[model samples]
Target: MDATTLNSQAERFLAELHRSPQTVRAYRADLRHLTDWLRETGHGLEREALEAYFTVHPHWASATRSRKQTTLERFCRWALQHHLLDRDPTLHLEHPRLPPPHPRGLRREDIERIFAVIPPEQTRDALLFRLVFETGLRIGEALGVHVEDLDLTRGDEHLTVLGKGSRKRTVLLDDPRLVSALRRYLRTLGYTHGPLFQATKNGRGGPLRYQSVQERWQGYAGRADMACTLHQLRHSHATELVNGGVSLATIRKRLGHQHIQTTLRYAEVSDSTADAELRRWRRQRH
Candidate 1:
């Protein structure tokens, strides 16, 4: 009914949901936007207030509106269940239909071109790019990796990555090129401890910042004359696996995707695959 009530309930709802910090921040932002609108219009937490707000902001993008709607519905349900409200304001709310995701990634040649620019002197930076590309790791997961997480001595060499929602998954280090590069990097460092990628600011070391990673990636992208982002390396890795006939289930586990549907977005057909499939289909028909 009020901003204070909404904020407190949102915190409880997010905690009960066991949402990731990133998700919690997003939900808080969405709630703030709605609460601000309510205050400006002198409205309360009711279905009429929500619909009126929606009516006022007709130009809001579908994705933005959809997120707000979900936040509102979630809050309304929580309020009703807790007897904070007489009825659910979002009982008759409609969910927006979102379009299917088409994830874009680098081709094999593109990856090669980007790697060409990183010289042997920058082994640390090169290793960073290779790790993310080879492992299909989110930047956060890759940065969070510790020295102990890498198991290079054992058979089926792999590294452990802590993914979204604090889920841990093993990423195999099967590529000879990547494996060799990692070995060289570790040898050069002459020590096997602490963060896999360490950042030193004012003589203190810690995990690398996301902004630092992005800036480094952009620098490499510019030198290589390519348009890419650190996140795109992950997409490129997934695309490569899918095109190589890797199973969806294996890809899902490797990428640490909670849902197979998220992995399915990478099932996009490459130009070569499309051509091959068409030729095969025509031959079978004939």
Candidate 2:
């Protein structure tokens, strides 16, 4: 079949799946790129054709190429299952080796400066930002927190969060300063129940939307002149724990990482830890 026809099939396939809009868009783009290459080379969507295309167009970054390869493989598998193709072309396709970059986290100085610059009037923003940094919680996980999820009573203090894949995990609320901030913010909101972070409208309460928090975060970033993301707070927290000699298993559990490899990325980012290891290695060599 022609590239355009196959491309349309791919689009229809993706539209029927329960994928996020962003994911659908990316998959569609990947499909389009593959079809375009096939058309240019006068080839069918076959294994040999794909291998040739990758060989000829070897300019993509490893990560980008890997993503595209995954997208194409999924598409090919679907096509084969649907009888659009006689066989799956991606069954034996090898993805390019990905060189994982060091995880980027905010410097201690940057974190301090940013927190210090948070205006007193923006207590909610301050609390949200600090909460994520203190507990390696993703922005979505932080925003998803309900009042009932918190256990700030005298003896125990932790928040239960629904992490990726709807898995639940308990994260400690260990910082007294953060606990104080949360208490004050909750008091100001007069919210004795429901979402810990709430939206106010006409003196009524509702769940605070992610978009509103993102807009507020943009303003905070601009004021602090820090080009960082809310997600980076999670990375910063994880890196801090790793550098402080926290065990990988403990860090993985705290960060809700399914794999220790994900938590190990923080260790990769800790230059001080790397330096210490290098010193140990040199002493051993001597």
Worst 10 residues of 2 by lDDT: 263-272
Q: State each candidate's clash count.
A: 0, 0
Look at candidate 2 and tell me the lDDT of residue 181.
84
User: Which residue pairs come into collision in candidate 1?
Assistant: none
Per residue, candidate 2 scores C-alpha lDDT tens digits across 102-190 of 76898878876777778888787789889999998988999899888888875568889999999999988899999988777767866
| Per-model TM-score on C-alpha atoms | 0.63, 0.64
Strongest candidate by lDDT: 1
The Cα error of candidate 1 at residue 224, in Å, is 1.6
Instruction: Go through the candidates in order and give each one's C-alpha lDDT.
Output: 0.83, 0.83
lDDT of 1 by residue, 67-166 (tens): 8888778777777888888988888766677886677898868877888898878777788888899889998888888888988874678998889998
TM-score for predicted model 2 compared with the true structure: 0.64
Q: Between which residue pairs do clashes occur in model 2?
A: none
